[model samples]
Target chain A: MSHISLFEFTQVVKKTLEKNLDPTYWVVAEIGELRIHPKGHCYLELIEKQGEKIVARMKATIWSYTFQNLNVWFEKITGTSLKSGMKILVNGEIQFHESYGLSLNIRDIDANYTLGEREKIKREVIMRLEKEGLIRMNKSLELPLVPQRIAVISSAHSAGYEDFSNQLANSAYQFHISLFAAEMQGKDGTKSVVEALKNIFKEIDLFDLVVILRGGGAQSDLDCFDTYLMGKAIARFPIPVVTGIGHERDETVADLVARTRLKTPTAVAEFLLNGMRSYEESLLRSYERMIGHTQHRLLNESNRINHAATGIKSLSHQLIRDVDSLLRIQQQHIFDTIQHLQKQNDTQIDHLTGRLSLGLKSNLVRSQQQIYGYEQFFHFSDPEYTLQRGFTYTTIDGKSLNKQEAPTIGQVLETMTLDSTIKSKIEEVK
Target chain B: MAKELSYKDALEELEAIAHQIENDEPDIDELSALVKKAKELIQLCKKKLKKTGSEIDDAMKELED
Candidate 1:
C-alpha cells in the first residue's frame, strides 16, 4: 500500500467492480451530461440522483473514430441532430490507469434502437390523447365564413404567421380577424400552443374559430405538429379550427381534425372567400330569376291580348251582318200582323240587339281582369311593362341559382337574355 | 330581419351574408334587414375576436416571464 500510486489503487477498485459485479452487461443509472472534447472525443458523466447520496458516478469516453462515424449515420438516418436529452445504450470496456481516474471506453452505440425507443414514447403519448377522444374535438367545430375571431397557434415572429395575417387582411373578402400567437414548432411549441388553447377556452364563446398555421419544413421537423399534446389541444378546442399547416402534400392530424384543411395561409383566405362567394351567387341568381320570370310572364300576357283582340274584331263584323238580316225579317213579319206586327217585330229586334251588346261588353271586361290578374300574380315593378329592361340570368346544369352561386373557372355557364342565349367561358378570376 | 341563427347556422348564414352584402346591388328595402343581420354578425365576430386577443395576451404574459 505504501508503494501504490492513486492509479494503482483505482486499478484494484476497477478489478473489484468488474469481478464483483459479475454482470455480462451491467445496467447502471445516471443523469448523463454529454460533452464533446476538443480532441475529437465524446465524454459523458453518469451520476445517480438521490438525496445527496451520490450513490455512484462514472466517466465515459468515446474516441473520435466511433463518435464521428455514429454521429453522421444518426443524423442521416433519423434526420435529427443528435444532442442532449437523448439517452443511449452503449457497449464498451472498463479500464483503470495509475495517473488517470477510472473511465469506460465506449466501443459501439446503438442509435437505431434509441430512435425506436423515442418513437415508442411518442406513440404512447399519441395513444393517450386518442383514447381520451379529444383528437377530433377542435376540427368538429363548425368553421365560420370570414371567420372573424380566430385563435392562431403559430410563432409570432415566423414568416408563416406574417403571411397568414397579411393574406387574411388583404383578402378580397373582409373578416374581423384576431390572432392568438403561439409557438408552432420545436420542443417548446407544443407546450405553448396547449397553453394558448386553455386560455382561449376560458372565454370560449368569444372565438369563431382557431387557426393552426405552420409553414412547410423537413419531414422530420414536422413531427412536433404531430405530437400528442398539440393534437389533443387542437381537438379539444371549443371553437371551429382551420389548419394551414405545411403543404397539401402531407397530411397532419391537425388537418384531419380541423373544420377546414388548407394547404397554405393564402389558401385559407381563398377558402373563406369562396364560401362567401357561393352565398352571394345564390342571392344574385334569385334576383335574376325574379326579373327573368317577370319578363317572361309579361310576354305571355301580351300574346294573349293580341289573340283576344283578333277574336273581338271577328265577332264585331258578324254582329253587324246579323243586324242587317234582322231588319229584313222585321219587314216580312210585319205583313202578317199589318201595322201592329211591324212595330212589335222592331221592338223584339231592338231587345235582342241590346242583350248581344251587353254580352260583348262583359266579355271584354272579363278578359281585361284576367290580364290584370296575371300581372298581379307575377308582381313585376309595373303593371304594364316591356321586355327591354336589360334582364339576364345564368344557368348551370339546365337549372338556375341566385347570385349566390359563384361558379369556378372552366365551369360551363349559360347566360340567358329575354330573347337570346349567350354561352361564355370563365377565362380567369382574380 | 336579423335571421335567427344557431352557432352552425350563423356561420353558414354569415358566409352567405358576407358574399351577398359584397356583391349584390343594395336594395333599399332589403338593405335595412341585411344591415341588421350584419350588426348581429359583427357582435358574433367581436365576441370571437376578443376571445383570441385575450388568449394572445395571456400567452404573451407567460412569455414575458
Candidate 2:
C-alpha cells in the first residue's frame, strides 16, 4: 500500500489541485524573471507587491503555441508591448506539477481586464499621492520661458522621432533637442527606455522637458509604455514628462504618469509651439493696452488744459468790456452837467441887461429862452424827481432793496442819496 | 449614471473622442463636440486616477504593516 506508482502520484497531485482551486479565476500580478525555453516554451515568475512586501507569488508557463497566440492577441487588442514588470491579468487553468511543484499553466489572457486593473491601481496611487501632498510636491519643476532643450526618447528611425525633430527644427523657434534612441516595443524596449531616461536625468541640466515619443507604431509596440516599471519611473521622476506614444484608443502607464500625454509626437510638438504662441500673444495684448491707456490719459490732460485756457480768455474779455461801458456812462453825465451850468450863467447875465436898458430888451428875451432851456436841464438833474419815481441811491454797502428803506440782514449797512446823507439806523428791531 | 465607467473604459472613450477630433476633415463643429466630449472624458479620467491612486497607497501602507 505504501509503494505507490509514479503515475498514480502524479495523478493525485493533478487531482488535488483541480479539486482545491476554482476552475475559472483571476490573478493580478507583475511579470517578472521571464524566460523562454529553447523548446518553444515560455516560463515566467509572476509577483505582486503590497508596498515593499511580496504579497503574492506564482510560477507560470505557456506553451510555444499558446504563448505566441496570446502575445499576438494581447498586442492586437491593447496595442501594448508586454514585458517584465508589466501588470497583467491571467485567466488560465491551474495545474500542479509533481516534479516542479505547483505552477500555473496559463491558457488565456485578457488585455482589457489587466488594463482595468492597472487603472484601478493607478487611481489608488494618485490618491495616496494626494493624501501625502506628494501630488503637488513634485510640481515645482519650472517651465522654461522658452522650452528649447528637449530630451527625446524613441527609436532612431521611428516616425515619431522624425516628426518631433523635424517639427521643432522647422518651427519659428529653433529648439536645441537631443535624441536618445531606444527600442519602443517588446520586453527589451522597457529596459532600454528606462536606461535612456536615467542617463537623461543625469544630464538633466541640459534639457527643459523630457519627451517620450513613439510614432505610428502598431498597438503591439505600446506595451512598453504600459509597463509598471515605466509608470513608476515616470511617477517619481525629477523632470516633467510629455508622452506621445501615438495610439488613438489606448493609453499606456507612461501616459498616466506623465505631466502631459498627447496623442502623437506631432501633437506634442504642436502643443509646445502653441504654448509659445499664446505667450507671445499675451505679451502683445498687454503692450497694446498699455499704449492705449497712456495715450488716453495724455489726450484727456490736453483737453483739460485747452478748456481752462478758453475759460480764462472769455473772463478777461468780459471784464474789459464792462470797464469801458462804465467809463462812457460817466463821461456823458459830466458833459450834461456842464451844459446846464452854461445855460444858468446866460440867463442871469440876460436878466441884468434887461434891468439896465430898453435896448437890451431883445437880448433879455433871448436870455429868457435860454433860461427856459436851463429849466428843462434842471428838471433832468432834479434828484427829488429821480428819488420819487421809485429810483433810489445808496452809499457804501447799502443799496436799493425791494422796499424803499428795507435793509438786508447780515450785510454791512450804509446809505446815501444823490445830494446829502440822511444818516439813520434800523430804529426798531423788527 | 452609466455605472460610472471604470478608468480604463473612460480612457478608451476619451481616446476615441480624441481620434475623431484629430481625423475628421477639419470640421469645426464636429471637432468642437468631440473636444467637449474629450474634456468630459478627461474629468472621468482624473476621477478614476485619483481613486486608483488611493488604492495603491492603501496597498502600500498595508504592505508596510
Which candidate gets the maximum TM-score versus the true structure?
1
Candidate 1, which segments miss by more than 4 Å at Cα?
A1-5, A13-76, A83-111, A145-149, A175-177, A202-206, A216-227, A244-430, B1-65
Q: DockQ for each candidate? A: 0.00, 0.00
Residues A114-213 of candidate 2 have per-residue lDDT tens digits of 6676667766666665565445432445566677788999889987888888887898886888888888877687899998999898998998888888
Candidate 1: C-alpha lDDT: 0.65
Residue A221: error of model 2 in Å? Answer: 6.3
Runs in model 2 with CA error above 4 Å? Answer: A1-68, A81-106, A110-113, A120-128, A138-145, A180-207, A221-240, A248-253, A301-430, B1-65
Number of residue pairs clashing in candidate 2, backbone atoms closer than 3 angstroms, sequence gap of 3 or more or interchain: 17
Share of reference contacts found in each model: 0.00, 0.00
lDDT of each: 0.65, 0.71
Q: Please, what are the lDDT tens digits per residue for candidate 1 over residues A197-292?
A: 787888778777777777645434445566776777677766777888865434555675566788877677667667778767877898899989
